[model samples]
Target: MSEHAKLPQDLDPDRPSGARIYDFFLGGSSNFTSDRMLARRVLAVAPDMRRNAVANRACLHRVVRMCLAAGVRQFLDIGCGIPTIGTPHEVAQRLDPSARVVYVDNEPVAVTHGELVLAGNPNAAIVRADLRDTEEVLTADATRRLLDFDRPVAVLMFAVLHHISDRDDPAGTLRSYLAALAPGSFLALTHLTADHAPEAMRAVTELLLDSQHPGTPRSKAYLESLLDGLELLEPGVVPIAEWRPEHGDADLATAAPLGYAAVARKP
Candidate 1:
């Protein structure tokens, strides 16, 4: 058996996991057959799903680069899925060798993969903790070592919040995380939305909810509400394709159906 196959009981392959599914969407090999099946279903509704994923990931890279340019050296990436090419640490460390990053995720396999990716990398670490349990993660040993809340830090939530059902109080959950950060800290968030293609999106959303990690699309109004106290950065609250897109508008116009992406700074 492969090393990942010999993984412990907590990394259950029977039920679909958000991390594995996302990895499949990225065309990574660190996923089970179940994850690929779900990815196919998701693609059926949004044919350009892979493009959408790439676009969102590009947004993440840009945001990280911008934050680093602003002198932010610490990073807290919540809901961080399975590590892939050009992870936040990889990008940030290149900019500032002293940069520190703490990755938080609720999935055991994701945490394992993240750790494996960061192995022997003294500047980064991953903490396997529930995203909703803000207090635990904030107080966890990993956080203590990798992040210093006294100074400015960048908190990234990419394509992960959608997994949090409204019933889970995602806004409240975000507030707690924001509350932990110091002033001048940055908040980078990108969420899945059905506002563009509601009919097809509804079917895909239902399939996800019924499978394992369920989610609901946040309307523009709802997404704006999440930015209540934070100071939104330039070109505020635009489509994922419009957020500092490297490619021209024509490419983005036909790329894929995606969510809204925003980056804000706490004053």
Candidate 2:
């Protein structure tokens, strides 16, 4: 709603975008004042927004490495925000040179920046599309060009599903993406939740609800329900900070708003 900032020609600086806000939180320079202001407001509500963002980002890296370690090199990253440090392509390709990734986002700024960062990387590309439109996302020219449907793919939807409203049928969206993957494919997700967080997070959630990135925090049970048909990995769905935390949570805010993280495999 804060629209008093400068944006790129293809972007509306006045309108706050989730990707830009996320970029701001990630310590990146791809966001505008409107995004920073909104991010700061959420920070006021949940003082640990930075820690929560770090935990969510850590989950993304872990999931990518986890899938790659399992020999799944191709990734279909839906709702991929603005490219930042340690992005999927960066992590995946560093571990395995042949790792292929198809990043998808609805924001023009994110897609534009993502393409710029990924330019000349034959194994990675970005597609601008809504995550809710599974058919279009799965069948896009870029997606088909960079990935093979018959092989196992790691479909990543990190910290984005909460932005999808009930009317969007988030559960069906998960199913649609899963149905498009091969038998050995995987679904990894990390979504915001108020289940184990402080009451202040509810205010933050409501604030975001009124913004361009309207999000609804689901319960732990509901978060797991999205992966009902798939086989969940060990540790199940837990707080993002606790999901295979490679480094000790020395500085992690234990009281940060919980963001549920989990990965399931298709049978």
- Clashes within 3 Å, all models in order: 0, 1
Candidate lDDT values, in order:
0.84, 0.85
On residues 80-150, what C-alpha lDDT tens digit does candidate 2 reach at each position? 99888899999999998899999999898888888889999999999999989888998899999999999
Candidate 1 lDDT by residue in tens digits, 1-267: 144566856776767777887787787887777777888888897776677777777888989999999999999999888899989999999888899999999887788888889999888999988889999989989799888899998999998899888789999999999998999999999988777878777877877874668878788788889999889998888788788777553365443366889999999
- Candidate 1 to truth, TM: 0.94
Measured over all alpha carbons after superposition, the RMSD of each candidate to the real structure, in angstroms, is 1.9, 2.4
For model 1, what is the C-alpha lDDT against the true structure?
0.84
